[model samples]
Target: MSHHRSPPSPPPPEPPESPSSVYCTPSPQSKATTPSPTARFFLSRHQSFIKPSPLTKHILPRQQSSNTLPPEFPYEHDTAKTSVGLYLRKHRRTNPAIWCSAIICLIFSILFIFIVVAILIIFLVVKPKTPVLDTSHATLNVIYFDSPGYFNGDFTFIANFSNPNKKLNVRFEHAVMQLYFEDGLIATQSIQPFSQRRKETGVVVIRFVSSLVSMSSNHARELQKQVMSNKVFYSVRGTFKVRASLGAIHFSYWLHGQCELQMSSPPSGSLMARTCKTKR
Candidate 1:
């Protein structure tokens, strides 16, 4: 037999170690003794950690807090307007331009208040009133027509302008008078400018001559009928520019006067009844 002996049988397997074999606590009796390196390593890893509960939640802030902002404050939305007053008005700063702006604003405010006061005072003191106008007399000098549509007439009137204001003198300028038979305008004339003292009346004499003035057939026929019946209807309209004088303050306005007259016909016609209205 060959002398090659089989390999020595393997050593028997050792028993498994306990689960706590890698870690051990030092007894109080060995407190003063230093541990080995391996023991120190195991001791260092002997910490205990708690597991998180499934139902628990963390407390975290919805937003981070800072000294520059208040918590839960109601704030106005910021805008991007480009006005210079957004930066300069009512802000705490040492700008010299702010003083100049403030002074100008104050001056303007004072001027506005002074102007308002002056107007109120003037209104109270003046107590201005409008003047009055009246038609005192009318005369139909003559009337003759060549044809039904052709008209010829001569008319005269006296206009009385009265100043009813207790403290105002009135002047009348750019005066014009118009004569109408029914709805047809027959003639127009301009009068001279005049003036009147307070509470005084002034008269203006106006004469109108119509030659070959064309009228509608209805107006012509109506005129003939009225002349035959010895009753003529005429309209007189007058316009004037009136100025009221109150010491250093004077104001002007337009004045209008209208008169309706019934008169006897032909050469001796005179006003029988009248209605007048004046307005501004």
Candidate 2:
């Protein structure tokens, strides 16, 4: 039988969209596939604002670290690089001042040593000599006896100081002269300071008077016997402070001398018959 099937009822019309479905479902795509300029700018901004998570040091790959550093770099790591930089900076600040002071001290020491060596060499080569001293005979200017045992006399003497060094100068500060008769002080004389040129001679004249000098009884008797026999004896002691100089170098010396005099007759006129013995 050709039964006319009623047309399948049209599918039920879709229900109006619910509020929950509208929020959960995706929007329909536009026919244009490429994103717009505004959308691209917004995506780039979002990516830039997002922060990356930290990398764990223990899990870092060795190859990645090696690739990041240049092969010719001296330090192995950041910490080592920082330490070397700090050491270099500190040394640069302090080393110059220290080195300057050390160099100055070394130079001064060398100069002082050189000066001392030069002085020693000059002294060895020079070989300077001390001055020479000579004494002439003394003459009696006046002689008198106030009492039997009291004897007095005025005597004149000459001293010759000669510098033997050809290139050295000599200075005599002072001279102390003492006259003795049988170990008793009879007179004393002092001379002023003077300077002598190289290989030059200086003359000093001294006059001393003995006043109220008493002799021992034995001495008086001996003196009387000597007077009758025309023989008399006297002693003189002298000390001189002298300085010898050769250029800048100078040295001091004490010149000591002892002399004995013998007179065979009383001194008269301009000359005296006397003999003198002297020692340096």
Highest lDDT: give the candidate number.
Answer: 1
For 181-240, candidate 1 gives per-residue lDDT tens digits of 876799999998888888898788888999999999998889989999999999999888
lDDT per residue for candidate 2 within 196-215, as digits (tens), equals 98989878887878888887
lDDT (C-alpha) at residue 265 in model 2: 41
Runs in model 2 with CA error above 4 Å? 1-123, 267-280
Q: Please give the lDDT score at residue 133 for candidate 2.
A: 60
- Displacement of the residue 118 alpha carbon in candidate 2, Å: 7.3
Q: Estimated TM-score per prediction?
A: 0.61, 0.52
Q: Tell me how far candidate 2 lies from the true structure as C-alpha RMSD in angstroms.
A: 21.7
Those runs of model 1 whose alpha carbons end farther than 4 Å from true positions after fitting are: 1-123
* Model 1 per-residue lDDT at 266: 73
